[model samples]
Structures are given as structure tokens and as C-alpha cells.
Target: MTADKIKAAALAHFANHGYSGASLSGIASDVGIKTPSIYAHFKNKDELFLAVTEEAIAREWEQATAYFKNRSSSFKEKLYGFLRSQKENYDEDERAKFWLRTSYFPPEHLHDQVMKDVYNLLDKMETLLLQEFKEAKEQEPQLNSLNIEHAAKAYIALLDGVFVELLYGGERRTEERLEASWYMYERALFS
Candidate 1:
């Protein structure tokens, strides 16, 4: 229970402050414990940060799985739905902000570790996407000419571009950019 509380506090701090700026004392205070009490759950800030990162990534996967399973009728629907859904972040959701920041600029010391973890998550996501693309190509005669591997890679690249816009462009700008970019991408794919 204490460990959960510690991690919960740490998540919020890390989300807003990033790895380097997050403060153990701040997290401890938020958890209603002294700074040293955190040592009982985590050896140091690095461990706590990694724990938070793992939990955050797990939560994202859970959400994605649920969304993928329940939403959309066809493969194109699911793909486009996922792309569109990615554009909608809760205004108060710091986790999304934290994820964007960490993806682009992890702590210098933990960059490799963070990238490894993120890439692992992306691998799983892409594998799922590839299966969908394969099925879609098999079902849609028009799509048979498209290479599933290339299509999947291009889709992932588009998603990454969205993330980049979300990181640097504010909400209004991202919305405009996403609308225009997604239209162009769809035209290029189908035309």
C-alpha cells in the first residue's frame, strides 16, 4: 500500500517535472511520508522513476488493448480510429505530456534504458498493427498491391509525426496539423 502510494506520487512528479527535475522530497511529501521513507520502496530516485515509467507504459498498453478490441469495425476503421484517437488527450492528463517528453528527451543517463523500454512497447504495438494490415490486404483486393511491411512502417512513422506535433505544437496547432496531415496521408494511401 505504501509502495503504491509512493509510486502514485512519483508518477505525478515525474510526469510534470521529467526524470531530472522530479524531486524525491516532493514525492514523499505528496505521499504523506518523509523523504527517507521512499527508500523503503525504492533504492533511489532512478529506481522510482523507472518504476513510474514502467507503470505508465503498462497503463498505456492496457488502454490501447481495450480500445483496439472494442472500437472500429474494419481494419481501416481500426487503423484510422487509433490515429484519430491518439489526437485526443485529456487536457489534464499529465501522463500524455510526460510520455511525449520522455520519448523525445529522456534523462541523459537513462536515455538508452528508456529507449529500449519504449521500443519494446512499440514492437508489440507494431506487431499487432502488422497483423491487421495483413488481414486488410488479404480482404481488400485494392490493397493487395501494398506491401504490409511498408504500410505498417509508414503508419508508425505517421503516428510518430503526430507525437512530434503534440510535443512541439500546442493543442490548436496540432489539431489543424493532424487534420491536414491525416487527409493527405489517406489520399496518398487510397489514391
Candidate 2:
């Protein structure tokens, strides 16, 4: 569909150029349309950017959390898998790049709008993590001593730290950080 093509082009441009540098004209050129055709799909660049951003955020969140739904994996496995998968996503996925870039460096005018979605996603992440931690503790005697709320918060913090490393530290450094953080997390949960 034309709309999908428009969005896809916008994603690449916005990812490479950032908000102010990306333009409707360029996006339209990529889509083989004139600048005004974009208006039919998106009211303005802001609307298009936010749409692409929110979509990327939602997709990234779903991908990052997919491990939690594994019926066969243990909770610890789920946590480790999440960290590994997120690292892969950051390294390979354009959407992840866009999501991370927009999240940290949103256009000045759209900061509030961007944060609103981001905060909602964070809240959802925390709640799901808390629930999973509680269930895992119930199932794993070793985890009974670990407070689920604290564990959830710590896990979220761990995720943030790992993401920061990947964003600035390259694949190798990110892998190093992931392993080290997992070790500490495992020790704390079991100790």
C-alpha cells in the first residue's frame, strides 16, 4: 500500500537523519511520490514521525519481551534470553535503531508526546516483569528470598544499562556488559 511505503521510507530517513534533518521531500522521493502526497498518508512530518516512532517502540517492546512467554524456559532462562535477544535486536534491526534514537533524542517539540508513549511502555514492562518475577519465585525455591518487586525494578534497571552500553559501546562491549550484568543478577537472585 502507498501508506506502508510512505512509512517505510520515513523510517529509513528518520533513522539516518534524525528529526530535523529528515524531510517530507526526501521521504516522498524514496517512495516515488511528490512531497504533497505524503500529506494524504500523514498530516505532517510530526504525525508521521510519531506514528513510525510508536510503531517501532511497540514492535521493539514485543520483541524484547517475547522470551517471557516461553512455557518451557525457566524464569532465569527467560531473563537471560531477553538480554541476549535485545542485544541482537539493537545490533541488527533498523527499528531498534530508530526506537533507541528517538527515545533518547526526540525532537524538542515532541519530547512530551514521545515520553508519554515511552512511559506507558515502561509501566507495562514493569508490571509484566513483576508478575513474572512473582510467578517465578513461587515456582523456584531459590528465588523465594528475592523480593519480586525489587527484582523487577532491578531487571528493568539492568535492561536500561545494557541498552546504553549497546547504543554507545558497540556489539563487543555490549556483549561484555550483558554477561557481566547477568552474572551479578544471577548471584543476587540466588544469594
Candidate 3:
């Protein structure tokens, strides 16, 4: 329970302040404990950060798994649903924002591990998408002309662009951008 509270506080702090700016002292204060107590749960800030990162990734994977398990019928519907759901899932929330911020702007010392996490998630995403695309192709021979690998790459790139937009583009514009971009992407791929 204390460890969870510590992690929750750390996630919010890191999301708002970035790595160097966040402090164990502050996290302890938020958790209503002394700084040293944090050491009971986490060896150091690095460990805590990585733990939080892992938790965030796990949360995302769980969400995606649930979404895909109960996903739509058509291939386009599945793709669009997953894409839009990500935007909804990650927008401005503490855990998601912390994960996104750390992913793109990790502390210099943890760059390699952060990137590894990114690659791991991407691989998982691609695997899921490839399965869907292959199934779609099997169902409609017309889609067989669409290269699954290429489509997966393009879709990941589109998702990355949306993440970048979320960081820089204000909330008001994000939905509009997503709609317009999704339309263009669908047209280019399907039409």
C-alpha cells in the first residue's frame, strides 16, 4: 500500500517535472513518509523510476490487450478503434503522461533502457497488428495486395506522430488532428 502510494506520487511528479526535477524528498512528502522510507520500497530514484516505467508499460499492455480481445469486426474498424483508444487512454493522465514523457525524454543515464522499453512495446504492437492484418487479408483477397509489414510500420508511425502531437499540440486540437489524420491514412491505404 505504501509502495503503491509512493509510485503514484512519483508518477505524477515525474510527469509534471521530468526526471532531474523530481525528488525522492518530494515523493516522500507526498506519501506522508520520511525520505529514507522510500528506500524500503525502492533502492534509489533510478529503481523507482524504472519500476514506475514498468508499471506504466504494463498498464498500457493490459489496456491494449483488453481492447484487442473485444475489438471490432472490420479491419479498418479495429485499426481506428485501437488508434483512437490510445489517444483516450494516454491523454494528460499521470501514468500515461509519465510514461510518454520518460520515453521521449528519458534521463541521459537511462536512455538505453528507456529505448529498450520503447522497442519492446513497438514489437508487441506490431505483432498484434500483423495478426489482424493477416486475418483481414485472408478474409478479403483484396487486402492481400496491402503489404502487412508496410501497413504495420505506417500505422506505428502514425501512432508515434499522434504521441508527438499530444506533447506539443494542445488538447483542443488533438481530436481534430486525429480525425483528419485517420481519414487521410484510411484513404491512402484503402482507397
Best by lDDT: 2
Position 48, candidate 3: lDDT: 95
Candidate 1 — which residues are off by over 4 angstroms?
90-92
Error of 1 at 71 (Å): 6.0
Q: 1-191 in candidate 1: lDDT tens per residue?
A: 99999988887887778887889999999989999999998999988888878877887788678877763487666777777777774245766666767778889999999999899888988887788777778787878788888878888888888888787777887778777777876776666
- Per-residue lDDT, model 3, residue 7, is 94
Candidate 3 wrongly placed segments (more than 4 Å): none
lDDT of each: 0.80, 0.87, 0.86
Q: Which parts of model 2 have CA positions greater than 4 angstroms off?
A: none
Model 3 TM-score relative to the real fold: 0.93
- Rank candidates by TM-score, best first: 2, 3, 1
Worst 10-residue stretch by lDDT in candidate 3? 64-73
Considering every candidate listed, which one attains the maximal TM-score?
2
Q: Please give the lDDT score at residue 141 for candidate 1.
A: 80
Q: Per-candidate TM vs. native? A: 0.91, 0.94, 0.93
Cα lDDT over the full model 1: 0.80
Better of 1 and 2 by lDDT: 2
